[model samples]
Target chain A: MTREEVAARVVGVTAQQFAMKTSDIKESDQFTVDLGADSLKSIELVAAYEEAFGLSVKEEEALKVQDVGGAIDFFFRLLQ
Target chain B: MKPYELQDVPTPNLLEDTFPYSLPPLIKFEGKIKETIDGKEVEFDPNEVRTRDIHITDTTFRDGQQARPPYKREHMVTLFEMMSRLGGPKGVIRQSEFFLYTKNDRDTIDACRALNLKYPEITGWIRANKGDFRLVKEMGLKETGMLTSSSDYHIFHKQKQTRKEAMQQYIEVVEAAFEAGVRPRCHLEDITRADLPGFVFPFVQKLERLSEQVPQHMKVKIRLCDTMGFGLSYPNAAEPRSIPKMIWRLRNECGVSADRLEWHGHNDFHKVHINGASSWIYGLNALNGTLFGFGERTGNPPLEGAVIEYVALKGGLNGVNLPVITEMAEYYERVIGTTLASNYPFVGKDFNTTRAGIHAGGLRKFEQIYNIFDTTALLNRPPRVAITDKSGTDGVALWVNDFLGLQGEERLTVMKVARIQRWVMDQYEKEGRMSSITDQEMEEQVKTCLPEYYQAHRKN
Candidate 1:
């Protein structure tokens, strides 16, 4: 899937998961952004994103995820 | 800072005490009885929109999915069947939890449409939008609860919209749902905090205008939610009112059919059910619930408690077997991978049991009278079961006493149950859970607390 498609799925799923609008999630959306998502929520979303796209975000790579775009890029690059 | 204790952060208003306090009573429901030869169960409530709640509604598939891994459509059907078995004045039709989450959600909606399921009007949750409502049709869902942010917090911080735009968007989105042949249920979030005069009044005036403009079933059923669990004006106080009694006042004063009013709540400090129960008393037609109060944050009032309160306190009907609900809770825990707290009151292992000799002595009469000598005991501290190991201390030379009442002996051959409880708690404390408590973990805590009872009752 293209970056947008992958991001769309992840954002769509995460938005629904947190009961928010997709517009609520920006490419720069931080897990702890105004949504007040804590670490547990962040981890849950990451795992779901991994599962939804069928890829792994290694622990070390996880430290580099700063926003939704970064997370999506990490997954997309892994796919490549 | 530790994580678990972090979730326990005190609420904002944490208002001083106010009302007669105790966990609300359990409800007993004798659902719609039939004159048919076999007495088959039925859903139609012939009564007019009067009484505690005229509407029987289920938000499980819609709300329960928020618990964790939302269910498959097939799973929803089975859950509905079970809820139907439990009984309700309103039949069960909670569209999937995520209003528009997945292809599977769409598939489930389509399956419901193909089956032509009727009973609990198939209402799905949605934001005010054309696409969001459009997905309902893909799932074959004909009814939907269209929610738009009403609270300033949601509009500005969450949705980044002015109240005016959200209202306009609401009308547009709702119209779309209608064009696609879906029933629209309207939910106004943070209604408890939204400015009644400035924000809410004008917005609702438009909806009122819409209700009058639309065909009857085409009209929306509005639900008021205490989203953040900011109970009434003051939640932290000893006698706390539920979130925004002012909302209830507005709901009542605004001339509308009881069908139009519904109440939803979360439990930051445990008053959502009381708020819901109060709404029922005030003539709101429909009340919402999750099977075991599983949802985001502190979660909504345990519908189990609401149903119990109706039957046990108000002499009304709910159509649920309160005893069996614990097992249903267990299922929720396993699926969500969490637990319940020992002190959760209704389903917890310690909710009905007593640990302190003085406390147990007072609680022994509760099953009969429904009142402990001091009601505060039940509130501040959940009924705890104390296990005293008298096997070695009582010095009966141990022929194995009644196994039922041996100085409340609650220890096992190797260790005391109290010690085990402490051990489990130590583990939980180390795990760290801040923000707000979720229902799944609360259930897990109860399971962890039960070992003492099991160990205490070891067979001879």
Candidate 2:
């Protein structure tokens, strides 16, 4: 998916998951800031990304991926 | 690699330092675990204790349909059966609480009345319209709820009526239902979302007066409907405590009762599960739910889940017959033609299933700890689990052998048995999809992971 699409998806997923307003999610907005994502949830999100997209994200490399764009880029690179 | 080696695996010290425990076979688990796979703790707040004399009537039928797969009539019957079976025979009538208020909906009400003729009392849901009351009358649905719009959105925008008009309308329709031999339970819809200071409280004040004028048996249920799933317990709501504190305040401050107060939540946000749970713990005896948690948009709290938790987990029933919930869900999903979100709470296809490495490892640890539910003082049930998620052929084979109790050879070849789920799951993660993975791809995963050295020990 495109980066913007990924961001939208992130916002959509986090909004529903966290009960936060979707508009509150911004590109620079840290997960802890806008979405109230806990440590467990952060890991769960990575698992979700893996499960949703069907790819392996090394637990080591997974931490470096931050924003929705980063996740999208990581996904595309792995895909290619 | 597993957290521990599969061979020479250290059996978990469950009861004492020396004893090893396996999962109990008699109990089927039905509660939310505060811990994640690796066993991080989650917090839960138990509300003030109150006598649970009132029964909750769930409307997943109306509110829960938006987000989920379709719920047909038979699905409704199955839910009724489950609700009854959860609480008891009396629980059946007290809990089989959904409504049909329109002539078009009479068939379902008639169906309920038919059920009631044999059993007496299947609760019904109703709109706040006068015409809706007529249908309740025709169906002879004695225990009926008549709902009227109280929120600005519903009154001004959807129903196009003024607050005063909605109140008057509520009075007119509820009175009509009472006159027609129906037990009147008025649902003040959108009470939370309503312009409360200006509209809701004043209307409620007058409703209390109207209620006093009627007989005490003429019940009025002020339904706190989070129509968009964003209710008073929401972060943006006038409060932040989800629905627990709200229900408590509504009961204590608003002068509503355990019997007359009903809480309805939507899952647009994920709080409905906690909200519904807290409402009961707080004070409201009647909590609403949908089957399979299916409903509009995100869906309602899975009624099966809430029932499971209430009876099987919190209240602790040793034999509540929850083993069939998954099977029932399978039947409903088929009729609805939508796969249950594997992650959907409780009865969802994968709720109890595990996949993550830590989770799988932990399952290998406490799969027996769940046996505690069956033996514990509070809860008792065998943990219900059937894993369809995992990674690596070894992991898959281990779980399969665990399921089949296979050991030592004579085990069916994984490669020849079917396909590779772990590799496919990994591929799915990496690429978002690998639709091209053929049956052969799965075969390779099984073959490479499982070799001739693997032996299933369970003897036929």
Candidate 3:
């Protein structure tokens, strides 16, 4: 998938996980700070992304993705 | 102060030298262990344990029976057979003493002899009386432990004999054992509370002289019994109580060989197991212990703990079947109708089970992080997580993955078990549940939440 497609999917998953609108999510918004993703929520987001993309991200590396842009970039690189 | 700096490296150093994960962590010794005995400095070579013929001797039937009701003949036979396998062919558990007083005891000894195992040579225990020599002769045993109480507390109070009378009585029994061709292991009861210079040393010297008259195989053995659990392994400790000094005086001062010396201790002060192991380091060969530390008053050193310690000191199993310890524990519970504490080391039900979420997380990532050693491979007990309010999603994930026997890529992540964790949390948070989530509850949650994996993996 392209970076734009990855970004769109990442935003969509984050919105669904936190029960927010897609327009309200931002690339600079931190998963824990700006968005209300607790430890379990962050894990849930990763699981949701894994399900949505049909890919298993390494737990340590996936948990390191801090923001929406970082998640998109991580999945995009994994996809390539 | 010497300067120190952090030598940061790219990779983590797990220090596999000691924590090899395949066995118990190796117990390495640095220089000589020193003890001040009789106003003189004495040094004992701790490294000798690596090559020494150090081993465990059992008193389960003798002292172990003293704490509880007697085990049936069949129970004794079965335990004896299991002990043979547990100690293996090399006889790490060299001898097990039994009571030869009753018809039941003789019958059990015969039944155990019927198994025809080589290790754990059955010996008899009797009072320091010439009449009891008949039982040893009748049983045709090679060795017997005869009580020769060393302390004034025992000699004066218990035996109602002066020091001279007690020594003469003990010597007569030893002579009788020699006449009967049975090796006498003098049970120096309360040696740790005795006058080492005044009585214990003199008695041991007399035993040494008696041993000189006999053949090497039939020589007198001295069991330094800490009957009151007053023995101390601490450095610079005083005589009688100091295990190091007592062994030193017996070995160096009175001329007793390491092989002929044994350390038997009680757990009145919770120093039972370490004191037994310390005896090995202090130059004794046999550590007298009962299974699960079951003995008089508090208990003797645990035979199973000594087995693990043997591996640690020797740095190898040396044919000892470690898993039989688990089997023995199961036998003690199932057949013997006894229960071991869940948190008891090595054989407990929850010895390797984790209750903390952080520990479960580490266990999920790498079991060696939370586990003491490879208990799963060694003791047939894998690291486990007991889910409660404290066990977060990580614990649920570990429990689920371990239950399904999933490994590598198939192991479930915390996200997959989040719902179960949520329900577990709600049990306490919402419903004020105060107990741990049982394995059955976790299995049901797996079936309900992660039914696909359960179907694919657990159905078998």
Candidate 4:
């Protein structure tokens, strides 16, 4: 998957997890602060990303992806 | 203030000197502990416990029975057999005193003796009456504890006898025990509430003098019974209540050797276990206790607690079988129909179960961070997470991995169990559930969420 593809998937997963629109989700939007995801919601987003991408990302590293841009970069590196 | 500077190091100083995780944390003493008694400073070497033959004697059938309904004959026999294993070959739990009044008690003693596992040698408890000597002699028990009430509260109020009359009656029973070749352990009932200098010291001195005439095996053992839980372990805490001073006086002033002196305590003040342990440090060899602290009124010092303290003080298990404590708890629940308090240490249902999110996270990262010791290795109980709203995804992940018997990197991550954690939250949030998610419910959630893993791992 390329950067745009990873970004689009990460955005879609984040939107689905937080009940928001993919258009409303942005690269700079923080999972907790901007998207109103609590600890459990953050974990659920990581789980959603794992399911959507069909890859088992490192839990600690994936959970550390604070913003939408970070999640996109994280999954892109894993896909590469 | 003393001059101080940070001695920073590259690695953490985990202080293995005291907190060696394989064993109960060791009780190390640097120097002698001093106690002021009768305007004199008495020094007791606390380190003596490391080498001393300090041990536990049980009163489960005696004082323990006083608190609750009488255990069935088989229940007593099973508990007695389990106690022998719990103590092991070295006899850390050296003796168990039994009631001699009923035929059922006698049959239970016979049944226990029939199993014939050594250590926790059977003994009898009876009033200070010579007639009870027949029971001790008939049972062929080498030792028996005879009540020799010490406090004026017991003598004047309860027994309706003056101090001299009570002392005479107690002495006659000791004499009868000697004649019958049964070693008399004088249970100095309510010694903590007695006039120690006036009555207790004099009584113990006389008993010691009497012990001089008998053979080594027949010497009178003094059990300093803290009957109402008034004994204090603090330094310079006044007499009649101060455990240290009472023990010091018993060993030094009254001339009772450490081996012949036992500390029996009650939990009326929640100081039972400590007071019993402090007696060992203050120079007594035997701590008289009951299983799980079940005894008269409040309770006795928990024999299991004392067993843990014994390992801590000795810095090893010696011959003690610690996991049998778990077995004994199970036997009590399954057979004897008793359940220990859920929060009770070492042997409770929730003793090692963490419910908090942050604690579960710590447990997931490193078990030692939240667990007291290796409970799985020591007590046959792994540290566990009880799923609740407070138990986050970390808790869910831990519970799932443990249920699947997964280990190391094979264990599923928090992300894998996040769906189950959401269901757990929905119980409290959406459904307004007030109780924790039971293991059965969690298993169903596991089956529903991670069907493949559940099928692969738990299908059997």
Candidate 5:
């Protein structure tokens, strides 16, 4: 869909994966540093996004996304 | 030192010259190996191995049985047949020696002889007694290895005879073997720790002299036994312990030809395999070994290792059948009820199994990264990923795809197997599991996560 739609869904998946409230999750938050996602958690977060968006993502490229905003941008391009 | 710069090429240089990936890495050599003996520098052409008929002889029944409970008669017969196939038509594995002490042993020899394979002509082992010649003559074995311990330790302490007495006693046995119309292979026990010039050389020279009087097939053969694993393969390593100088003296000084010479080693110092291989490069024709390095004490040089070494040196398998190594391992585990260490090279359960996530990733992209040569092609064992908490998604994907028999583009990716990977991690992370996930457990996960693929593939 749109970048805003992607960002909203990415933020929801990120919050659910980290066990944080959706309102507390920020666009600038880095997955590991700010949200406390480990390597496996980061992979789990990508899997969550794939399930929520109903689309497949390139594993290497998707895993490279560092933050909520980066995840949004990655999915936005894949969807286009 | 000369200045150097990196080429920084676009693609990786895989160095296929040494690591052809289809076979064991080739051992390329340059120039000659030189050693100082009696104030003279002697040069040995290491490259002679390529042209020489370097081969393996087995003592699995003789020395291999010494370390473990005696193998049943049927076990020996089955193993002998497998050994013949393992060494193949050219007889890379030439002769297998047996003990003639028991009726069962002689019966096993008779049974193996019935197979009538051309290579690994069944031979016998005995103490250096003229009396033992009766057993060899009775068995109809063309060649037999007789104990002729050479060191002062063996001569004075063990045999309780002076060097002259021991040498003369050994000569009498060789003469007896000739009279019996059997070739005698003199196993110079503890030669690595022996006084080579005084005892070993004089004795071998006498044996060589005696060999001249007999027909070519009946000539005496010499086995340099590093009985205590004291032999060193290093260049210029001193005296009796140096394999090169020891072999060099026997070949050049004592007038023993390479064909009639064999190197038998023990693994007391873990130098058995290398010392045996070094003897071949230093110009001996035969490496006497036992299966899986099972022999007296720390065992002998592993015959399977020697087979791989032979291929690497010759740069080809010649006539060797590599898959029989796996068969032998299975036979040892399943029939013989003995399990090799999981990490034993080439033939163990975990020999080609990778556990690291990064390694699994590399293996998924290119198998050569984590595997040594092509185990699938050579040993009938493909590279495997053992699933653990640290195995990550790549490991799960590899395991699942291998389980499902998927390949190339059809192979499931890490993302596709994310749910199974999560379950695998949760085994240790959530359930506090401490053991690796078993193949049976992984099969359950495949049936759960990818039921469609499982149903489609395993429907029959």
Candidate 6:
């Protein structure tokens, strides 16, 4: 999948997990600071991304993704 | 202040020398321990325990039975058989004393003897009466412990005899044991509360003299019974409560060898196990204890605790079968209808179970971080997580993985068990549940939430 498609999917999952709109979610928005996602929620978001993309990401590495842009880049690299 | 800096090495140092996961933590000692005895400084070499034949003797039938209802003939027989295995062929648990008074006790002894497994050679406990000598002779037992109360409290108030009179009466019983070809173990009842220089020393010296006349197998053994749990393991803690000075006086002054001396303690002050372990370091060979510390009053030093201490000091199992401890606990609960406290070390229901979220996280990452030793390999009990409101997603993952018997990369992650964790939280927050989530409830939740993993991994 293209980086645009991965970013769009990442934004869609984040918005759905936090009960926000896709328009409100930004690539630069931090998961914890801007989106109000707690530790468990961040884990849930990663799980959601794994399910949507049909890929298993290592927990330690996946949890390191801080912002929407990072999650997008992380899944893009895994998809390649 | 000493100059010190954090080296910050690339690798973490877990100090495997002290915390080897395969065995109980090693008990390393440095330098000599000195205590003032009768205005003179006496030194005790703590390192002597490494080579000494330090072992455990049991009073589970005599003292342990005193605290609880009597075990049936079958229960005693079963427990005795398990004790033989727990101690193993090396006989880390050397002898177990049984009451020879009752017909039931004698029958139980016979049943235990029928098993004929060596190690934990059976001995008898009797009152210091010349007539009791017949019981020892009749049972064909080689060694017997006789009550030789030493404290003025016991001598005057309890026994209603003067120190000299009590000592003479006890001597007659010891002489009878000698004539009957049985070695006498003088249980110095309440010695920690007795006047050491006044009565205990003189009496032990006389007994040592008497032992010299008998054959090597028939020599009198002295059991320093801290009956009131007044014994202290602290350095220079004053007599007759100081365990070090007491053992020193008996060994150095009274001429009793280390092998002939035993330490028996009570748990009134919660120092029974340590006091018994300290006696070995202070140079005694045997630590007399009861199973699970069950005895008169606050109980005796726990025999299982002493077993673990032996492994720690010896730095090896030495053929001790630790899994039998779990089996014994199960037998006690199932057959005997007894319940041990949930928090009791080694055998209790929740002994290794963690309820905290952070601890569960550490346990899931690497079990050794939260577990004491390798409980799975040693005691047949793996580290577990008890589900509660405080147990977060990590705890849920741990419970599920352990319940399903999953290992290695097959274990589920916290994210995978998040739905159950949310359910657990909802029980307390949304439903006002006050109790811990039971394993059955957790199992049902696992089936409902993680259906695929549960279906694939569940052991029928």
Instruction: Tell me the lDDT of model 6 at B282.
Output: 96
Q: Model 5: runs farther than 4 Å from truth?
A: B458-460
**Per-residue lDDT of candidate 5, residues A7-76 (tens digit):** 8898888888888899999989999999888777777788889899998777888888898888888888
For residue B386, model 5's alpha carbon misses the true position, in angstroms, by: 2.2
What's the true lDDT of residue B152 in model 6? 95
In model 6, the Cα lDDT at residue B457 comes to 85
Using DockQ, rank the candidates from best to worst: 4, 6, 5, 3, 2, 1
lDDT of each: 0.55, 0.55, 0.91, 0.91, 0.91, 0.92
Cα misplacement distance, residue B98 of candidate 1 (Å): 5.5
Clashes of 2: 38
The top-ranked prediction according to lDDT is 6
Off by over 4 Å in 4: none
Report, to 2 decimal places, the DockQ of model 4. 0.91
Instruction: Give TM-scores for every candidate, taking all chains together and pairing residue i with residue i.
Output: 0.56, 0.61, 0.95, 0.98, 0.96, 0.98
Candidate with more favorable, higher lDDT: 2 or 6 = 6
Candidate 5 chain B — worst ten consecutive residues by lDDT sum? B451-460
In model 3, residue pairs whose N, Cα or C atoms come closer than 3 Å (at least 3 residues apart or on different chains), thus clashing, are none
DockQ of each: 0.01, 0.02, 0.50, 0.91, 0.51, 0.60
Q: What is the lDDT, from 0 to 100, of the residue B363 in candidate 2?
A: 45
**Model 6 off-target regions past 4 Å?**
none
The TM-scores, chain A only, for the candidates as listed are: 0.81, 0.67, 0.97, 0.95, 0.93, 0.97
Better of 1 and 4 by TM-score: 4
Output DockQ, candidate 3: 0.50
Question: What shift in Å separates residue B273 of candidate 6 from its native position after superposition?
Answer: 0.6
Model 5: share of real contacts kept: 0.28
- Writing each residue's lDDT as its tens digit, candidate 3 over B338-417 gives 89999999988899999998888888888889999999899999989999988778988998988999989878777677
lDDT of 4 by residue, B113-185 (tens): 8997888899899889998888888888899999899999999999999999999899888989988999999
| Candidate 3 accuracy as lDDT | 0.91
* Candidate 2 lDDT, B82-177, residue by residue in tens: 545554544522444554643434555555445544332466667767777655656655667666767788888987887778778887877777
Evaluation by TM-score, superior candidate among 2 and 3: 3
